[model samples]
Structures are given as C-alpha cells and as structure tokens.
Target: MPRRVLPLTDVQIRNAKPREKTYSLTDGHGLYIEIMPSGSKLWRMKFPQRGRGDNRLSFGAYPVVTLQEAREKRLATQRLLLQGIDPGRYRDDKKRLAAEKGSNTFEKVAREWHGNKVPTWSERTATNTLRRLELDIFPEIGRLPIHEVRHRDLIDALRKIESRGAHEVAHRIMAVCKQIFSYGIQIGLLERNIAADMKDVLKTVRPSHFAAIDTDELPDFLAALRRNESRMLKPTLICLRLMMLIFVRTSELIETPWSEIDLEKGEWVIPWQRMKRGKLTVNPDTTNHHVCLSRQALALLRELHAITGGGTYLFPNQRDHKKPLSNNAILKSLERMGYKGKMTGHGFRALAMTTIKERLGYRHEVIDRQLAHAPPDKLSSAYDRAQYLAERKVMMQAWADYLDSL
Candidate 1:
C-alpha cells in the first residue's frame, strides 16, 4: 500500500531552516520546500512521468510564489499528469504558444513595423498613419496571425472603406498592407507579400482642391474676418489673421506652441516637430522652418502673448490649457463668417503661394521653400530647408506689408 501524505502549512514552511547540506521538507503528494545551504527556499513539485520514471517541476521560491499559489500550481500540474502529459513540457508549450501569439499577431507586427518606419516621418504623418492603421486595419485583421491574412480578406475590408467614399483611404490601406507583409517576409513571418498583388483593388480617386478665396477678394475677406462677431473666441479671430499673414496650414497654425516663436528676433521658427513634412522625426534639427515676422505679425503675436503667455501653446484650448486649439475651431470660424465653401482654412496656403509668386515677384523656389512644400527626397529636403532664409525674410516682410496696404 502507498503511504498517505499530509499537506504543508505556512508555519511549517516558514519554520524551515538551511544547513551545510541541501534538504527538503515535504508538504504532501510531491509538493515540498527545498532548503539550500545559502538559506534560499524553493517550492518544488515531484510527480511521476507518463508511464515512466519520476519528474520534477519548480513551482518557484517560497513567499514570492506563495503557499496558496504553489498549491494551485501543484494541482494544475497533477491535472496535466493525470492526462498522461509531462507537466513541465506542457507548461513550456503553453509559454511557447503565448510568445508566438504575442509576436505573430497582426497588431503586434503592425505596431513594430510602424515604429521602424516612422523615424523619418513628420509628426502629422506619423500620427495619421498610426491612427488609420488602428481604426481601419486593426479592427478587421489585427488579431489574426499575419500568415492567415489573404488577398480576399484585405479586398473585402478595402471594398467596405471604398463604399463609404474613401477610395484614397482604401488605397493607403492596401499600401500599408503591402508594406506590412513585406516587413513580415523580411522577419520570416510570411513567405510572400500577398499585398504585392493588390493593385486595381480599389476605386480610382480624383484629386480634390481645397476651396480658396480669389486673390481679388482679399480686402473684403480680411475685413469680414476682422469684424466677424460670430466667432466667440478672440484667439480664434487672431489665429485666422495669423494664418493669413504667415500663410501656414491650419494645422500648423492651430498647433503652434509659444516656444516656437521669437518675438524679439522677429522670427517664428516652426520646429520640424510641428510641420506636416515627413523625415523630420529622423533628423529633426535639419527641418526647423523659419517664418520672418513682420511688424504687423509681431503686433498680433504680442497681443496674443498677453492673453496666452501663461500657457505652453500660443492658442491653448479654452477648456484644457495643455492642448492647442481644435482643428475644427478654424474651420467652424470660417463657416460662421460665411466663407465655409468659398474659403476653407487651407485656402490660405494656395492664396499665399499664388500671390507671393505673381504679385510679390519672389522666386518660386523661395516661395515654395517658405510654403514648406516637401522636397522629393529627405536629404534634398533637409538641404533645402532655410536655403533661401535671407530671400524668404525679405519676401515675408513684403507679403505682410502688402496685406497691410490692402
């Protein structure tokens, strides 16, 4: 007959001491506290192997892997043993499966790929890319294994996006799919990029131009913007004026932090971190954009500073001082001024680009560089940054004075 074993209590386990030789205090049915000469106590379980000799598994050290938890592990191991499985091997297999699941899921790989790819991407591009991937890609196939993704699965998702009048978004999604699959191949997770075969899988899209005010309408529009009483926030009105003077994208204007400006230097330096141009993240120092401040622009900044100087942002959110002004604030303000369809917030760039070239007679390269049009390559782009600083500063003052003259 087999000997009956008793379970170990906490007191018994705690009272255990070490000696020169290692020894064990058995709890019951294979669970014991093994006391080492170094005064370390480890909880170990000894069980019979499947139709073979004895096998042992470490539950963990005492106190850290507590008495109750150790017993639970022992019970779980015994359950596996009853099924004629090796408890250690079963646990190891489970661990392997978990690790594989962690590294092989589409979300995991996609995030990893994004991290690798965005070192050079502008803050906007980086943010938008991740946001789109999370919203569109992650929901559909992010949980599945990368290898399990099929062309049809992607086509279906793209089709749904296209159905909602987002043909361009669908194309971008397909491109992301191809890139991710290619990355997976490099990492040995996929054999071939199924996304490579996804051309003509989405609807063709036409380029849409942002509605801009005609160059001839500047006087009326500026007058309308200055007197617009519908906009509740004074800062919103000032922001619209600044956008016209600086002619930056609405995003660049609204998101401007006070640190980026230099009222004394007569310059507002839009850090590479703020601009929509990509590759600034990789080499941030090379892309800081310079906007020469005219006296009128400076006057506006000084006025705005008095109101918002306490906060980090030039146009801090009314409710939350930490955040910048909302993107919609400018658009809605335009809408309120009855320029909703006639002139969007982005229209300022087009207006400035055209007028700076035709009316101001500045070089196209100078105007384009000031407008922050991204160059063809990152190296060329970085080289192009502030190349015409002296010329641009002159152009900036002229443009501002011209606005004042009108």
Candidate 2:
C-alpha cells in the first residue's frame, strides 16, 4: 500500500523560520518549502521520472505562491508523471518553445526570408527590397512575433507608406509581407497568416503609366535628338537613340555591361539575374536572356564602344567610372530636352511595341518574346528565350530601319 501524506497550510509555511543552513519542511506528496539561511523561502517539488529517478521542480517563492497553489501544481506534476511524462523535460521543452517564439519576430523572419530570396535577384532588386523593409515595415511592427501580426497592423503600416505618396512601394511591400507570412506558415512558424486576409484590402491604385510620347511625335523627337544644338553629350545622344532601337527595358539599358554584349555575334545576353522575375516562380532563375542585335544597334554600339569600350560598362557613370550610369541619367536628360511630361526613356519600348504591332504587323507573341517577357510557365519561358532567334534578328533590323526613317 502507498503511504498517504498530508497537505501544508499557509500559517504553518509562514511561521517557518530560517536556520543557519537551508532546511526543507515537507507539505507531503512531493511539495516542500525550503527555508534558506538568508531568510528567503522557496517552494520546490520532487517529482519522479519514468526511468530517470527523481528531479526537482520549482513552484516559485513562498507567499507569492501560497501553499494551496503549490499543492495544486504538485498535483498537476503528479498527473503528468502518471501519464508517463517527465515534468522536468516537459518544462525544458516549454522553455525552448518560448525562446523560439521570442526570436521569431516578424522582422527577423522577413529578413531571413529576404536573405534566402535575394540570391536569385539583381543587385538593385536586393537593395530595394531591404530598403523597403528598413524604411516601411521594420519601424512599425517588426519586433512583434510572427503570429501576433494582425491584418490591421500590416494595413496600418502600408497605409502610412501610401500616405507618403509611395503607392507602388506600399504595393510591393504588402506583396512581400504576404510572401513572408506564407513562408512562416510553410516553415511551421505561424498558424495562419493574418496578413493573408489582407490580399484585396489594399486600396486599388490606378496603374501609374510613365510619360511616353505618341508615334507621330517620334519624327520631331528624332530630329530634335540629332540637332547640333542639342544640349546632350555625344555619348548620351547615341545612348538615347540606341534606347529606341532595342527592345530592352530602360533600366537594363542604363546598366549594360561590356561583357554581356557580343558585337561579333550580334547578340546581347541579359542574364536571368537581371530579368524581372518574382519570388514565386519555380523556373531556373539564371536562364540566359538573349537580345538579337540589329545592324543599326550594332553600329551604334560600335561607335559608343570607341569612347567607353575600354571601360567595363558600355554606359559608365562619368562621376563613378567603375559603376553603371545612374538610373535617372537618361530620364533627366529627356526632362531637360522639353519632354518632361511627354517622352520618357522607357517610352521608346512602348513606341516599338505599339509601332511593331500596329504598323509593322508583327505578331504580339513575337514582340513580347523579343521583349524578354517571361512566358506563363517554366517550360514555355525556356522555349521562348531560345525560339525565333533568327526571326527576331530580321524583325529587329526592320524595326531599327523604321526608327531611323522616323
């Protein structure tokens, strides 16, 4: 038969005095009060492990945890023992879980997610992503645990960003937050993304179109571009003209490196690292993007090459020769040319896309492919990049001729 032990009373515990050394007074059933030499009282419980013998667990200090509470905790520990669980090990697990939760703040998780993601992106993309978090999200609710992020919390953060007139940044930040929360869910750090429900909650902003000139404005635009009295530098004028002849985006144009262009082969390869790929794609992020160089485009490159050919970049920043030209270089140049709200550097691509489709009668598929638009799937994008290289060369020459004629 098991021996029965009596419970302790508060009066008895409070009346207990400290001795020269620590001494324990049993309340029975694994509960006891230890009176220390310093007159402090501590509540402790000696519980049994399945095969690991006895271990001590703390209920807290005396008076703060009354005898009744200590008894209740002792009973709970007994129940755990009866269920074949070790109270000490269980407590250790709880402590570990708490530590993990403490470290799993929204900012920490988002940065971790960002770190894993930026390897597949361009330097500009990686920099912009981190800048968004630092400027927008981190100051608001970054320190909170991932699960503690409410929809209103994210909405409030993004709305603050939107109020500052950074609408596109707000949009991109929300998309990134959704991805981070989804990542937390995938990695077992969160239950459900409260931020997920906010997918459609952001204010629908009308797409901001860049200032692009019409097709008919091109003849005057070209004539103004080539005028001897033009304020632009010789290298910049050639760059502005080449910007129209190629299907490349203005950003890619500004950062064109000498290594990526092969004049001998009449090809310019925009590495996948520079392509506009979102984080969700399963496609190989490093796919080679080919740009068919037209004869006019080649001639312009050759001419510009004589000037900047010795440098690493085709269009080098005059102030910082080692770096690509500032993204605003061409845009500002156009602004000075009385086309501030009329024509943009990127307007050239739209001009080509519109003209090639409407006037030249090229297929949309061919135009989009030449523009390096990622197809819907990995297989299709792969096939598209390599397909119609020959056809693209012919189309590119005709397109260049059309621009020169204007």
Candidate 3:
C-alpha cells in the first residue's frame, strides 16, 4: 500500500527546498509543494482521478499566492470535481469565450473597417478619418459589442460633433459610423447596421456658401499677392494663383508633392486617389495627363522650389518639415491680405469659373475638364479624357501673364 501524505504548515513549506515534499492531511486531501532548481516554490493538490490512477492540480506559486488563498482555490476545484466537472476544462472554455467577445467589440470592428478603407483614401483623408474616430467614436461605443450598439447610442455620439457647429463634420461622422456598422454586418459580427436606420434622426442643414472676390477686383488682388513681402506669404499667394489658374480643388494644391510634377512635360499629374472624385472614375490616361505650366507658373515653381524642395512636400509646414502646409494656410494668408469675407480658398474655384466663362471665352466642357468636374454624359464621359493639354497650356500662361500685368 502507498504511504499517505500529511498537510504541511506554512512554516514547514517555507523551509522546504529543492526536493519533492509531501504531506498527508487529515481531510483525505494530500498537500505537496515542489521547490524548483531556481528556488521557486509551487503548491499542488494531488487527488485521485476516479477512473485514472492519480492527478495533480497546481494551486499557485508561493508568497505571491498566500497559503489561505491557495487552500481556497484548491477547495473550489475540489467542489467542482465533487459535482463531476473538470475545473481545467471549465476555465479553458471561459477564457476562449472572453477572447471571442473581445474580438467582437465595436472598436475591433471599427479598426478592421479602417484598415480596409484606408488603402482607397489619400494620406490626408486617411489621417483625418482616424483622427475623427479617435476623438469621437473611441471614447463612447468602442468597447461595446458591435451587436449591442443601438441607434440612440450612435446618435448621442454624433451629437458631440453637431454641438461643435460642425454640421458637415457631423454628417461625415454619421457616414463613418454607417461604414463601420456595415463592415460589421458583412463580417457576420452584427445582424444589421443600426446606423442605416438612424439617418432620419439627423437634422438636415444647407451647405455653407463661399464668399468669393468680385471678378472685377481679381486684378487688384492678383497684383497685391505678387508684391507681398512676407517670406511665409509668397508661396501661399502662388498656390492661390495656381488654384485659380487650374481651377483644381484647393486640397489638391495644398497637398501637392514634388514627384507629381513633370517640368519637361509641363503637366502636373493629379493621381485619381487624390482627385475629388474617388479612384473608381479615374481614367489611367486622363489622370496622368499634365496640367500645362506657363512660363510664369514655371518661374514661380522654380523660385518656390529653391526654398521648399529639400523637403518632401512642395509647401511644407514651417514647424514640421515632414507635413504639408495646413489646409487653411492659403486662406489665412488671403485674410491677412485683407480679403476676409470677400474671398476664401474655395472662392478661387468660382473665380476661375467666372474668368473662363466671361473673360476667356472657353467652352463649358473645356472649363469643366480643367476644373476636374465630373463629366455630365455617362457614355461620352467614359470616352472623354478631357484633352485640355493644348487649351490649358494656353489658358494657364495667359492667366499667369495677366497676373503679372496686374
């Protein structure tokens, strides 16, 4: 017959070293503590497995797990065994469920959604979307299970953006929420997107109108911009001039990279991803076509290059050489030049429309293509590459020369 073991006191266990020590206790329970070569001590409960010979269940480490705590844990496992359950299997199942639950959290789904959509967005757009999520969504429903998110919870979260008087941003946040929820549905994390049904709760507001400079005053404004002396002020003036000359969106100009320009070809190839219309509509041939550069525009780029070319962006932020100039940098310069409320960054688009229509006598199609406006005809639009290379070259030079004459 095997010798029975006895329970050891805390004092006896503490003195026990590098050897297998066993104690047969009074309650038909056997206590065994093992001291490893590293001098670390472990407590184990050795009990009979009804069908099997014998098994050991590790209670815990010594010191960190007190004697009382280890005994309590041992008793709990014993009770489970008495109820015909395997404590080890039960613990493993609980851990597996917890991991699955964590993976289904709203934040996890949102991150996955962001990862999928980021490749389709420009660097700037991706940055802005993540920033918005970090600021707004992450704090509220980020940890909640995706399936449990309600419309009211999403509305309350978006209301924070609305409260800031950023109605447009609120709308954008709603779109982001919808996208994330939709992704959850597609991935089988949620049965349906609650954001899809919450659109009616949001208030509709008119788009804010931009205040543009009167067409007659553009000459004086152009002249003033050319003569401005502030080191920081000149590049923005040139950027504004280019925006007006090409009628491309202000965002395109601000984020312009040096690699996108081809001086020999006299074209600035705006990638489809960077264009206002997303990448799907971009024609490979059209997207790579150059915006014709005039002598004056070329001269301006040369001069600006002398100052900012050492960096990656054409117009880098003064404080951080890595980042492009702030989106409002040009608008702010216009305000400093006393054009506040009279002209905005977007005002340049209107100015170009008016100039091409009233002053230059260009066709609407030519003007719209130069502006990169979406084509009106579906079939012709598919075929139309907006071949404005020759016309734009002439128009840009004339516009620059006109600015010089101002």
Candidate 4:
C-alpha cells in the first residue's frame, strides 16, 4: 500500500538520499516532491494510466516552483483527469490545433498570394498591391480564416475606405478581395467566393472625362519636361512622351528590358506576358511581334539608354536600382507641370486614339491592333496575327514629327 501521508522534513530527505538515492515527500494531498541525486528536487503526481498499472506526471522543478505552486498544477491536471480527459493528450491536441490554425491564417495566405502573383506583376504593381494589403486588408481580417470571411464582412471592411471618401480605394479593395478569394477557391480553402456576388452592391461611376493635351500643347509640355531639374524627372518625362508616341500602357513602358529593344532594328518587342491581353489569347506567331520606333523615339531611347542601359529596366526607380519607376511617376510629373486636371498618363491613350482616328483617319482595325485591343473572332484572333508593324511605324514617326512641329 502507498504511504497516505508521507511528509518528510528537508533535513530527513537530505540525510536519507545517499542510501535510497531517491525519495518522495507527499503532502496529505495527491501532490508529492521527489528528491534526486544532484540535490535537485521535482514535483510529480502518481496516477493510473487507464487500464495500465501506474504513471507519473512531473509538474515542475522544485525551489523555483514552490510546494504550493506544484500542488496547484497537480490539482488542475487531476481535475481534468477526473473529468475523463487526459491532460497530456488534451494539451498536445490543443497545441497541434493552434499550430494548424496559425498556418492557415489570412496573413499566411496573403504571403502565399504574394509569392505566386509577384512574379507576374511589374515590380511597381507588386509593391503597391502589397502595400495596400498590408495597410488596409491585413490589419482588419488578416488573421481570420479566408473561408469565414462573409460578403457583408468584406463590404463593411471596404466601407471604411468609402467612409473616407475614397471611392477609388473601395473599388481597388473589392478587386483585391476578388483576387484573394479566387486564389483561395483555387487552393480549395473555400467552396465559393463571397466577393464574387458583391459587384452589384458597389455602384459604378460613369467614366470621368479627361482633357488630353493637343498637338499645340505638346511642345510646351515637352519643353517643361526637358527643363525639369529633378534627376528622376527627365527619364519619366521621356517615357511619357514615348508612351504618347508609341501609345503602350505605362506598365509595358516601365517593365521594358534592354534585351527586348532592338535599337538597330528600330523595334520594341513586348513579350506575350507583358502584353495587355496576356499570353494565352495572343497568337504564338505574333509572340515576338515588334513595335516600330520613330526617329525621335529612337533618339530618346538612345539618350535614356546611355544613362540607364546598365540596369535591367529601361526606367529603374531612382531610390532602388532593382525596381522600375512607379506607374504614377509620369502622371505625377504631369501634375507638377500644371497638367493634373487637364491630362493624365491614361490621357495619352485617349490623345492617341483621338488623333489616330479623328485627325489622321487611320483605319479603326489598324489603330485597335496597335493599341493591343482584342479581336472579335477567335479564329481570326488565332490566325490573323498582324502587328501593324508598317502602319504603326509610319504613324509613330508622324506622331513624333507632329510633336516636334508643335
């Protein structure tokens, strides 16, 4: 039979330890302290492992853990055991579950999304998108399960941005939510996207009218750009002029690599991935299709290359050599040039479209193809792969000549 009240004084334990080597001192309760070889003591509780003979649970080291504290820990475990729970297994299971849940958190998923999507986006696009997520989405629902995010919850979260009178930000948040939820769906974390059905709830505004500077204003704008003092401003202004002359998206402009530009051939070949329609739909034959450069565009590129050709990007950010300039850099330059309300980066597209269609009388098909607009017929899209190289070359040269004339 076990000793019911096996209390022994500290001196008694110290004296008897050399002979027995180990001894237990029990309070009247279930708590007991074991004295060991190195004069170290530990608290332990004796209990039966159901259907097994006997088991012991070590509460903690003694001295650091007083007798009272050991008794409390033992009583808590005993209470759990009495309630038909195995304290050891219960604690282990809780820890395992907590770890699993942590792995599946929104922050973890956002990180995964970043890893998968960053490579596909331009450096600026990836950085700005991540900044938005960190500032807006992560702070609110970043720890919550992606599947558990409801439509109302997402709408309410974006509503906070709406409350700040940022309708554009609200739209951006919705787009990001859609992308994240779609990613979650693809990975099987969610059955259906809650963000998919939220489109109708968010009202769409009519496209705002922006005034594109005409040919008459081009000379003054170019003069302003040339006269700008900032080291970072000139390349961006040249890029803006190139964008107007060539009429490609700012992303396409900023992400242009030197390897893709054939200075001798007078061409710029944007890859299928960087193309506006993405690679899948663009015909394989036209994969390496080239953009014909004007004399002015070529001269600008030559000068720009002399400065930045050492870098991978044609227009690397001033602050970070590894990164391209921000998409807004050109627009911001225009803003500083007192053209904020009158023109924008996108206004270049409108100016080109209007000039090509209304002023120059270029065929709609030619203009559309140059602008990388989608074709109507899938078969023609696959087969009729024309880069409008000859016509675009002439148009670009004439457009540059017009700017020079201005």
TM-score of model 1 vs. true structure: 0.66
Query: Which runs in model 1 stand beyond 4 Å of their true positions?
Result: 1-103, 118-126, 272-287, 373-391
Clashes per candidate, residues 3 or more apart or on different chains: 1, 0, 7, 0
Clashing pairs in 2: none
Model 4 agreement with the true structure over 111-204: per-residue lDDT tens digits: 7988898766666578988888888888888888877777777777788877788778778878987888888778867778888888776657
Candidate 2 to native Cα RMSD, angstroms: 4.2
In model 2, where is the ten-residue run with the lowest total lDDT? Answer: 277-286
For 1-406, candidate 1 gives per-residue lDDT tens digits of: 9777787889988888889999998878799989999989999989887567887888889889999999899889888878877887888988896677556988889999999978666666789989998888889988889888888888887788889998889888888888889998898777889889876777777788999987889888988876785655778878888888888888788888888888788678877666665344443444677777777889999999999987899999888999989888888888888888888878998999988888888888888888888766777676665377778777888999999898
Candidate 1 lDDT: 0.83
Instruction: Give residue 76's lDDT in candidate 1 (0 to 100).
Output: 91
lDDT of each: 0.83, 0.83, 0.74, 0.75
Best by TM-score: 2
Q: What is the C-alpha lDDT profile of model 2 across 225-273, one tens digit per residue?
A: 7663368776787788788888588778878889898878877888876
Q: CA shift at 300, candidate 1, in angstroms? A: 0.8
Model 3, residue 365: C-alpha shift (Å): 1.3
lDDT for position 200 in model 1: 76
Tell me how far the alpha carbon of residue 256 in candidate 3 is from the true structure, in angstroms, after superposition. 3.4
**By how many angstroms RMSD does model 4 differ from the true structure?**
9.2
